[model samples]
Target: MSERDADSDDPGDDAEELAWETTGTEIDYTCPGFDVRRDDVVLPNGTETGFHYVEEPQAVVILPLTPDGEVVLIEEWRQAVGRVNRGLPAGSAEPDDDDLDAVARRELAEETGYEAGSLRQLFTIEPANGLLNSVHHFYLARDCEPTAEQDLDFNESIRVSLAEYDDLLSDVLDGEIRDGRTVTGITRYELADRWQ
Candidate 1:
């Protein structure tokens, strides 16, 4: 069943039979995002390996825009990419926060010293498909203004840039903006005519 459809089913006597308990042991394998353990368990008549996975917090990324077709972005050094990556402002989510849009606004100001006058939710993604449980929420900001203080992490070295709307697609395709989220946000916005 699809993730969205799983919760849509009506509860009945069949609900009790939805999940079956495995009667085998579990063994763990990795400790990347968090500690994980897997073990073999008895399932029906055969043995099944059950995995215990750990979780982390969710994250948010904001793509701020102007009514005049301008995209405000950041260019920062990334160790993995071995160079600078230009993209939207993004960061981890906070538990106390009710939604990702709030976090997106916070991160936008902190990273770029720019505050979105208005915020619109875009999309959410599971950045890693492996063991870790993390999400990246995307947002669209309008009429943003620079804040007095920039909330940058101690580990981050970021610069700021603004690209015109009509030219954004070409910029992303030309490799000027190389970050995945950044590229997606830019291309999607341009394609949707949101920049207009």
Candidate 2:
């Protein structure tokens, strides 16, 4: 049964279903990181609309937890925002990356100079589902230890630090950790058992 008509037990369930039909699409712009596109879609009410959206590549974020239960975070300058932002180690998938976990591990090592003893995925999230088409794969890297010097890109400048898990959660709830993906990761880790 269609979800819109499930509660009513109506015979015309198919008629009550809401959907949008994409009649046409055009690429407005294409760049290295993302592409902007416009879709011509007809709504359930038969109204035609032009929806502009961004198609971004998939990305990954990792929270590296040390043996003492400290969470590894990165302090980096965001050129787009013109300010220093604190967040988990994260990066988009490179062309050679096999999967999201590869991207996550590479980002974690590159940004924090640590290797995870045991890495496990927490969840995948779509922080900007309305405007951007991308997924942020979140992982928990426990028992992390420094292995090598950070290998950052020329455009990247990052400082790494470890904070207590509770303290990180406090910062997240107190508006200190403002990055949306980082917030999602921390909240997911903090509330995992509760959700299960």
Candidate 3:
């Protein structure tokens, strides 16, 4: 069923039936960018258990398009993966950032030195809900142009490049682009017309 229909008064919908009740929550660990949260919950069957997840601030990912229709991409060193990963410009929202569009613009400028002439939100998604409490706000940035030098964070190592949209899509499909946000952003942009 469609998500909207399922959210309505659907006779067979069992959302509440399988829901778990959270009795309490605690922070198991704290870090600069994320925290480990543990929730004490009662399952549908009345079994008590603890669920752990990584809680983080919302993030923004930009699919930047130059006036020539090329996509701005970033190649960055990923310590977790032990290799450089290619992806769209993305960053977590800072505590002082109140506007998502501003965050998107900031990240794009910081990572790639590109500024968007026009920016529009495409969609939001939980890239990994089962293990992480995170929301990714996806944006489509058009007419992007390099206007400044990259102002990367202390720990960041990024290189910016432009690629044809078709080539980026091909990389995603051929399993060369494994970054989830980049893949999702590219696919969403491709399917945006049908969704609208």
Best by TM-score: 3
By the lDDT metric, which is better: model 2 or model 3? 3
Please, what are the lDDT tens digits per residue for candidate 2 over residues 100-160?
Answer: 7777778889889998899888887777867877777888898999996799988898999
What is the Cα-based TM-score of model 1? 0.70
Ranking by TM-score: 3, 2, 1
Better of 2 and 3 by TM-score: 3
Name the regions of candidate 1 deviating beyond 4 angstroms.
Answer: 1-55, 192-196
Write one digit per residue (lDDT tens) for candidate 1, span 60-88. Answer: 77877766658788889999879988777
lDDT of each: 0.69, 0.82, 0.88
Q: Indicate the worst ten consecutive residues by lDDT in candidate 2.
A: 1-10
lDDT of 3 at 107: 93
Which candidate order results from sorting by lDDT in descending order? 3, 2, 1
lDDT of candidate 3 vs native?
0.88
Model 2 stretches astray by more than 4 angstroms: 1-16, 193-196
Task: Residues 1-196, candidate 3: write the lDDT tens digits.
Answer: 0012234334565677977888888899997889998889999999999998888888999999999999999999999999999999999998788999999999999999999999999898878878887889999999999997899999999999899989999999899999999989888778774246
lDDT of 1 at 3: 18
Q: Count backbone clashes in candidate 2.
A: 0
